[model samples]
Target: AQSVTQLDSQVPVFEEAPVELRCNYSSSVSVYLFWYVQYPNQGLQLLLKYLSGSTLVESINGFEAEFNKSQTSFHLRKPSVHISDTAEYFCAVSDQSNYGGSQGNLIFGKGTKLSVKP
Candidate 1:
């Protein structure tokens, strides 16, 4: 069994401030970790992912997350955030198991609502 836990339900930051969204997971086997962002009234978008290879993965939008297997944590961070960066962020995990012959479902955290202020 695998599960993700977001330590914070909400984070408030001023514009151009550094921010970090914490995430931790527990699983018996190896897993893939991801961060997704959902803008107001829109669908979720992939922010970054850690599948294999390098433990440090980055997104084009100045966000980075490092996969720490020993800690079972994949924390998302950005040096400076903009007002537009405010959104609901979700942390998800998926194992290699394909349930019912379908793609394995992603277990997601409750999400952290990032509120960027002016």
Candidate 2:
């Protein structure tokens, strides 16, 4: 079945450091890629998405990801992170294109926990 995979369960970084969260997806039909961030004690918030157009997408908070069709990957990245950046990041895929008029849901990965230290 179609699924999303998060290569790292956890990532630790200093107050100011670069980080990358790896993600890969497998699906028979076309899909939309999304990256979500869940801060502590809060709901998941959309970080970025790739539906069409440029393969590269970025979030307002300095996060970015590139959709690679050949590799079936959409890895999340940040050039520099702060303590507030600590959170659980999830990679998700939606087969909305194939669903046509039907309701669609996101297929999420296990998630990568990002821990930022002082």
Candidate 3:
């Protein structure tokens, strides 16, 4: 079985400040990692994913995550954040057993709320 843990429940940062949301996972087999973000009054949206190749994956919105196999961590980071970056971030994982690229069986973390202040 695979499980995900997000280290922080909330992260408060000033605008233009850097931020990092930590996530760790435990699994006996190969797995895929993903970051999902939910803005106010919106559904969760995929921020980035790590399927294969490239230990580091990035999202268009200036967020990046690195897959560290040794540490079993997929931490999301942004050099500078804006007020719009405030949202709920979720870390999810899917083992190889989940067939056909389906995202139905993903294990999710408790979620981290990013609060960007002026």
Candidate 4:
């Protein structure tokens, strides 16, 4: 089984300031990591993912995350944030070894609320 943990429940930052959302995971088997963001009154959208090969992944936006296997962490970061970036961020992990059952099922952490203020 795989599980994710978000270190902070809420992160408040000023617009244009750098921010990081910490995420950690534990798994008995190989896993894939993902960051999902949900804007106000919107559904969850895939932000970035680390399946294999490269350890770092970036979203279409300015956000980027590095998959550190040794640390068991995939922390999301941005050099500068905007008011539009305010949202609930979730860290999820999928068991890559499990292909037959619950194919798309992912274990998720309690979301972190990112609040960007002016």
- Cα RMSD of all models vs. native, in order, equals 2.0, 1.5, 1.0, 1.5
Candidate 1 worst ten-residue window by lDDT: 95-104
Candidates 3 and 4 compared: the better one by lDDT is: 3
Instruction: lDDT for model 3, please.
Output: 0.95
Candidate 4, lDDT over the whole model: 0.94
How do the predictions measure up, each by TM-score?
A: 0.94, 0.94, 0.96, 0.96
lDDT of 1: 0.94
Show the colliding residue pairs in model 2.
none
**Residue by residue across 37-86, what tens digits does model 3's lDDT show?**
99989999999999999999999999999999999999999999999999
Identify the leading candidate in terms of lDDT.
3
lDDT of 4 by residue, 1-21 (tens): 788999999999999999999
Pairs of colliding residues, candidate 3: none
Instruction: Supply every candidate's count of residue pairs whose N, Cα or C atoms clash at under 3 angstroms.
Output: 0, 0, 0, 0
Q: Report lDDT per candidate.
A: 0.94, 0.92, 0.95, 0.94
Cα lDDT of model 2 by residue, 1-118, tens digit: 4699999999999988999999999999888899989998899998999988999999998999999999999999999999999999999998856557214888899999999999
Residue pairs with colliding backbones in model 4 are none
Put down candidate 1 lDDT per residue, 1-118, tens digits, no spaces.
Answer: 8999999999999999999999999999778899999999999999999888999999999999999998999999999999999999999999855553215889999999999999
Q: Kindly report which residue stretches of model 1 are placed more than 4 angstroms away from their true locations once superposed.
A: 99-102
